[model samples]
Target: MRIYFLSRRKLILLLMFLITIGGLLTINLLTQTIPSLVRTPGTYYMAKTQEKVVALTFDDGPDPVDTPDILNILKEKDVRATFFVLGKAAESNPALLKRLVKEGHEIGNHGFTHDYQQRKLVAEMNQTDQVVFNSTGNHTYFYRPPGGLVSKTQMEATKRNGHVVALWSVDSKDWRNPGVKQIIDNVMKNVFPGAIILMHDGGYQRTQTVKSLEPILNALKASGYRFVTLSELRTLDSDLK
Candidate 1:
C-alpha cells in the first residue's frame, strides 16, 4: 500500500480553485432565479391578475419566412399577440411591420441591432421605435431588452423613454429547436394567468417554433385561457392595482 498527501501549498491552491468555481455557479443560479422573484417598477416580467388571460410575445421577428407563418396561425386562431421586433429586420421588411399593425398585433421595440450594450440601450430603443413608426406610423410603448438582459441604468433609461421593459415568465425554449412537442410542453407546463409567454419568430431557423404555435394556442384555448397583447395584459394588470 502507498499513501500520499498533498503539500500545504498544493492543498491551498486546490481549495481556492474549488471556491472560485462554487462562487461562479452560485452567481449563475442567482442570475436565472432572481428575475422570477423580483419585479421592479417599470419592468414587467408578468402581470398580476387572475382573469384567465395571458400575453403572447414574440421576439427577434419580422422574418420574411417564419413570421408570416406564425401570423397566419394567430389569424386562424383569432388570437392577437405582441411582436418584439428588431429594427434591422423591420427595416428590411417594412411591409411585414405594416401587416402586423394592420392585423391588430402590437409591436414592441427589441432594439435596433439586438445587441446587448447597456450604454447604448437608449439609442438602440430609439432606432427601433423610429423604424416601427416609419412602417406603421405608430410608436411602441413596450421595450424588451435583447436576451432579457438589462442593467439598472438601462431600465431607468427605458422608463425615461416612455417604454415599459417587457420580460417573460414562461419561455417556450423553442429557440433551441427542441422539437415541436417539447416546445408546446414547455409553455403549457409553466403558463399561468397573467403570464407573459416568450417565443422567438426570428434569429435562426425557427421552423419548430412556428410548428409549435398552433398546438400551444389550441391547448391554451382549451384550458379556457384567453390570449392578449402585452398592452392589453398591462391594462388588465393595472385594473388590479
Candidate 2:
C-alpha cells in the first residue's frame, strides 16, 4: 500500500511538470506570433503603406473643452484624425461625437468606460458605433484599445465586428506633459510612414497635447506627408490592395 501511494504521488508530480512545460511553450508560441497577427502583418507592427501618410489616434476623451479645440485645429490644418472616444464619455458628449462625424474625422471605439484590456475594450467597441450611429445611424469602422493593450479575445471580437485593432507605432508621451518641445522632438525623431501615433485629447495634462498638434502637423506636411483620418487611412490601404 505504501509503494502504491508513493508511485501515485510520483505520477502526479510528473503530470504537473508536463503541464507546466506545455503551458510555457504555448505562451511562448503565442508571444512569438502576437506582433504579426495583432498589428503589423506577420510581425504585429504597423501596417505597411507606400503612401507618405500616417494615422493619428486620440483616446480617453470627448472632453467638453479640449476635444472641440483639437477638432478646430484639425480643420484649420486641413487634417483629420481618429478619435477613440470612451463609451461612457460618449454619452455626455453626444454633440461632440456628432461633430466628429460631421467634420469628417473617424470616430473609433475606445471602449465604454475606457477599459484597459483589449477584450473588454473590443467588446465595448462592438456596439459603440451602433449606439452612436443609431443616434444618427451611419456605419463607421474603427477600433482602438484603451492604453493600447490588446488580447486574443479583443482581436477576435474586433475582427468579428469588422474592425481592425489599431495600434500605435509612435508615442510622444504627450499625456505626461513632457514639455511641448520634448513632445515635438519625440515625434520628429520617431515619425514614420503608415505610423499610427497615439495622443489624448481629453485626459489630464492635455494642454501639452493641444500644444503639440500644430507644429507636428505643419512639420509633417512640410515634409510631404499627408494628414488623414483613421477611416481614410484604412480606405487607402484597402484601395492599395
CA-lDDT, candidates in order: 0.89, 0.74
Model 1 regions more than 4 Å off:
1-6, 16-42, 238-241
lDDT of 1 by residue, 76-147 (tens): 999999999999999999999999999999999999888866557888889999999988999999998887
**RMSD of model 1 against the true structure:** 3.5
Q: Give per-residue lDDT, candidate 1, residue 36.
A: 38
Error of 2 at 163 (Å): 2.1
The list of candidate 2 runs beyond 4 A from truth reads: 1-45, 118-123, 238-240
Q: What is candidate 2's lDDT per residue for 44-94, written digit by digit as tens?
A: 225467888988878888899889888999989878888887777777788
Pairs clashing within candidate 2: 35-43, 35-44, 36-42, 36-43, 36-44, 40-44, 40-45, 133-137
Model 2: lDDT to the true structure: 0.74
